[model samples]
Target: MVTSSSLVYLIGLPLFGAVFLLLMGRKADKWGHLFATAMSAGSFVLGLLHFFAMTNRSEEERPITQTLFTWIEAGDFKVDAALLLDQLSICFVLLISGVGTLIHIYSISYMSHDENRRRFFAYLNLFVASMLLLVLGNSYLNLYVGWEGVGLASYLLIGFWNQKPAYATASKKAFVMNRVGDMGLTIAIMIAFATMGTVSFDGVKEAVDRVGTPTLTAMGIMLLVAAAGKSAQFPLQAWLGDAMAGPTPVSALIHAATMVTAGVYLIVRSNFVFDAAPTAQLLVVIVGAITLIFGAIIGMAKDDIKKALAASTMSQIGYMIVAAGLGPAGYAFAIMHLLTHGFFKAGMFLGAGSVMHGMNDEVNMRKYGGLRKMMPITFATFGLGYLAIIGVPPFAGFYSKDEIIATAFNSGGAQGIILGSVTLLGAVITAFYMTRVMVLTFSGKPRWDDGVHPHESPALMWLPMALLAIGSVTAGYLFTQGEALVHWLSPLFAKKGEYDELMPHSVVTVLAITAVIIGVTAALMKYQFKSVDSVVPTDVSLATRLARNDLGQDVVNEALFMRPGQALTEGIVAIDERVVDGAVRGIGAMTVGSGATLRRTQSGYVRSYAALILLGALVLLAGIWVVTQ
Candidate 1:
């Protein structure tokens, strides 16, 4: 039986660790690592057990839901603190907890020398637990709690190097941008409650089915806003690009594996709602397409190793969102892509981190080269990641990315075809930038300052990269299993209904192989043969300049949004200090003045008090006598 006890452990373990670290402080550093790591591992094992147990059970027992207690109740409304274990949730469980364990283990070695290792592990553990809650939650309210918790963890981890002002600012930016997206989600939840009578998943889904199209459209749009925020879509994507300020492992966990994927999960979880609203699905496609192109273009100009990876992460997430809009076939493609992405993206980020570790935290590509010889393992693994992400033949990205693109082409009509073309071009760009990264950072003459020696990272760092690299190569092959990826995820997507099977196997294989060859050729021409160093012209065209400057998006946000916000905050504070405080002070002064005039009548003498008392008594007696008359 699926136990409520497992749900409690998922949330409680990390929280207990956080409290334990707070109480123990620096003295508990080693124990904190031990406790946090063990708890994370334990949670992963439980999740695995839950997954296997469900697989052996019948359809009636497929969904194992555990309700701990009632969280909120009033009138006819109620939402329970519940957790769910199904094929869908189990997938998330494996991703978050399994990868989370490796991250923790890597952190043990990676963070060993840092002074605040205890606190670092604490936040890491908490992040994993919260993400687990997010995916496992049976209701939106509980999911939101986990959602905000992951945000909190992201803020903490991004600013983990708080001694640096830039890191701190990056952390704040992530939190603020997410809050902007969250407002939309909160409003959507309220709409669900008002119309549907409850916030629970079953209630909301049933209510949505009953309320018809308009309500579904509204819900879908609001959710899209939320997903846009969480997934780092077009308008709100700046924070994610800057999130490179955090540790490499953090970038892996938050961007690649857990937090950013929350948006895709949210959309997948609410598949039925999107099915009813074509407009909402269209919006998803539009925003995702825009982000895909934009991210790919900007990625080309990023000279920082992590920032380029960050841009690519956003670009890949765009593809996932596009698939999510494609109905059941698309949704399954998106989840499969999420799986492959987690493997490859995490590997890339961690490998980049290992590079940074060996180079004394130097991340700029212009400052380094000729390290492939020294860091053979890192280079090999990272190259594998590059191949997978670029959808090179037989790699993980090939199966999933192709499925989404093909499905989008067919389902989205002519507009879908255009989107598919842009995505195809994006694959080319993905190859170019990745090759640029490898070439600029590893192939050229040593660009380091005099007296510097760069070498391979420690064993602990490379181990995770190695494992992820393997997944990056192998995960997509799971799609080639019985009936492909879509068939595997069929149960979760209720709205798929009766649909034509996807294109024949031979057609899909030919298209996928052709795309891979094209991507590889583009990369080879751009980096290997055309030579990035020699090909870049000194006088760039305006279009090239715009791409070089990240399409000037950062400048616009700073001028229109970020700067104005700072100014507005300053103005509000000034008003609070000058106008509001002054007004309150004036009121206090007036009361004091009135009291002074009244005090003049109170002479410090017993006769004065007696006179006032006698006058009051005489008035009372006169009133009584007049009444009697």
Candidate 2:
């Protein structure tokens, strides 16, 4: 590995922006957004240089490590505060910084009307820096530092408009749920130390063969818990939709492009560990399968444009996680999907933001229709993203997502079939909901209310979306050309995971396209031909209500986890009150009673003291006389 000090600048520029703007406060408000954007763009430029530099090097020389200082040093255990820019991490570095810079550009106008636009840029800078650190970390311990930084930054960004109670609650919800997942990562690191005697990625990889399967499995499961939480998978996923309470730029930048994708990075980064533990790997696939379907169902029922995209983000991430879970065979494909997803998902989110911007900050898709002519750029950009996500030919998602589905199907036995079928269903549901979003928002007649005028967002906002839309159109094809991305990423994994096809590539493509057609036709027939009620209907089918409520994820969380957790917390408090506090209170009461009794004996007079002393003397003399007689 090459050692280079230049690696720090990739993270430092944005980190500096965040710290500078925050410390300068109001004094920097006039130019804070511009400064922050420049910082992010600088990082992107640096990443591009590194990418080009890396391409010229041999496989062995591609990874560059920059060790800053010793992070931890204690008997037989040590960790370095360091960064690694390898082929895998470089992809993330570019994605985080590149997409991040665009989002920064978009937010310049998106947040212009807000009073705290400076602070908003500060948070955005912080988020970009933290995410850079996460992807760049040399060790799990180092990664955790970035992980917590990300959590903190996300909390601040999501709750930027904290005057609103709902937004505040949403941030708190994301924070608390993520903490629950964070614990899993912590435990996994500890397990790595105790069992493998190391927490660094290289160390862990080297030690994987030495450790028992159960140990590796435990570690992998813990890592999955962390991934699920960060990526908004399964039980930990409920917080993502509500996170739309933040600014629309936030949804695009953090939720769609950077932070949410961190989980996929984690799982794929720890590929060696999961590869050594089949049980854990299987569990990973299961979680992905469940969440993909789970999120897609919820997407089908959401009226809020941002929340609908949020659900799609969850499902798309599920596809990545499932690919990650497939071990070596699916690892590169997972990253491919992640990179393409960064473009399309981020674009769609910005598109949602653009729609909201033009429509007086209104978020309900039910009140939107026939916006294509009014906001032609937004429609075209968003339309490209839509095509990419649904696996339409030549778009970004078609190549990447198809690879995952094919990989899953070729995994063999019952597992392959189940995974393959689940992915197909997920794609169908994805198509249906995304089509619904496009139809409801841009295709039908305008559903405007009083005093609302639909118009295009300023170029400052749509420009970023337009760039990302181009990425959405071309990223997939570029990644798969001559199997470029997988070949580039191949050496990092322990094994080359290419497998013989269970089903021909042609057949899989045909099936996927057919599924898309079915989904699109269904959504068009169901939503496009019918008049959408401006308001959500209260009386609906049980399934529709369930989907609208995130497939009862919150209810399940409340009933099985939240209520039980709350009850447990209350019970613990009760126990503390009666047993722990009661004992202390009892001791206090005894002390007070004893003090009260002793207080009477201190009856304040010198006369009382003298009389008691005289009585004692008389008694002493009488006792002496009796003894003498």
Candidate 3:
């Protein structure tokens, strides 16, 4: 049932679109967005067909590979430019193409007024193509190609508005931070090649038993570092907030749905390595736990709408990472959360864009209020996404997030207890911050600037928002109620004995619900009926100040990494100029001085040269005679 060309078209079409748009240039500006959207939608349709084809086959036959060509061959090392279609990859393909199509459609209207609309769509297509390659590639080397492709595309998209200095700076920041993580991935690949003698998933998985625990642990940790960077976990999380400087649609597509989730995919994709190393797995959980709290705390204090959403994204990804770190027991739930998150978060981001569109592109939430009446569609759609994210009952986030919490409690031991507690706290804070965003942006008195007029966005923008909102409401139930996603992903993980929950599922659900209610109530009390000041106050509590400054992450980076790095670079530069360059120059100077002195003996007349040669011979002969005597 699997068509050989299916995977090729799925990845190639978007790449073709990107190339086409780039070649067409400004001439296609009038319709390039439409062409890009069609290409993206086509890929999604292909993915759907592939999914159906996969479903028709038995579970054992679900995974199929399509080899385009042999990519590398050196000694015993061999690689194929191939794609693998399995439950795991199919899920990502759907998420990437599905959400990607919507983002593309939204961009059509969102970027209509811009002069560089064609270029933007081209970058978007490139991004989709890169992501497809990333998820579909069968080997680590192949994945690396896609990985760097993604980085390149993101750099272009994030800095698309390069005329703005801040946007350019943000793009550089994201690029640099990701490089820090990419190094980890690079090392991980090298280790895989060195230890396992193979870089393919199947090869590595099979070699796990033969490989030493230390080597596996090192590889696992390095992979986690890579995941943390791409996924914006912990130390690498700082760039994501600043990344909000890009256009809103870019935020929705790259930050909310596809690019930021790359880290989670990498970790889950390499679950085999993590399974062999408990220490590395524990570190994954620790990073996830810390980041969830870190992002939530920051979200609570952010006033910029996009920055707040970016923080929320960080927090949400942290939750997924936590689940991923739990080993096979939690991988399914982690992916489920990621899928559900793609929908809701993308919806929220697009909705924010809609709000910005109406508010004359204002990003500060403090300047927004009571526009729910004016922009009813944006309000309704955004509210659905907000509800889903807060884990309100029957919403998508409820099923995915609650399962993660339940699984954490069931993981057993002190680690479980601590992680469960952290998850619960994160849920509460998630609800609080999300509720705060909703109330400030839509519920209270209008705080609009004097010249600003609020109105609903065109159907092109709201339609995608509406569809994503619908996904946010229903995806969790469909994926979780029947253990559907878990079963679907079973082949990727080993069968383990099911553990009983420490508390009843019902009790845990209630506890989570209670936290949500408290968070909602707190936000409603503070903002629902009140008027907010647009100007941020300088005087604030210590905690508020810390959160406002992003927990001093930049300061920490400056002190611990940036300043030290700068000093080291300066030292190296000095050495290059003063010592290295000086020594080279000194040699040149000695050669020049010697040449000048030797040139004096090169007289125009042959007699002058002959006389000098005779004198030199006589001196040499005399020295030889004296030595003999």
* Model 1: colliding residue pairs: none
Worst 10 residues of 1 by lDDT: 527-536
Query: Which tens-of-lDDT digit does each residue in 332-412 have in candidate 1?
Result: 888998989998998989888888887888888777777799799999999999888988768998877877777765664
Query: lDDT per residue, candidate 3, 1-629, as tens digits?
Result: 24366788888989999999999988898889899999999999999998998899899889888999999889998888888888999999999999999999998899989999999999999999999999999888889988998888888888999999999999999999999999999999999999989999888999999999999999999999999899999978999998888889999989999889999999999998898899999999999999999999999999999999999999999999999999898999999999999999999999999999999999899999888999999999999999999999899999999989988888899988999999999999999999999999998788889999999999999999999999999999999867989999998898755787787899889989998999998888877755577788788899999999999999999899999999999999999999999999999999999999989867799998789889999999999999999
Where does model 3 exceed 4 Å of error? Answer: 1-3, 587-629
Ranking by TM-score: 2, 3, 1
The local distance difference test score of each candidate is: 0.82, 0.93, 0.92
What's the C-alpha lDDT at position 21 in model 2? 98
Instruction: Name model 1 segments beyond 4 Å from true.
Output: 1-5, 495-519, 529-539, 566-629
Ranking by lDDT: 2, 3, 1
- How do all models score by TM-score? 0.88, 0.94, 0.94
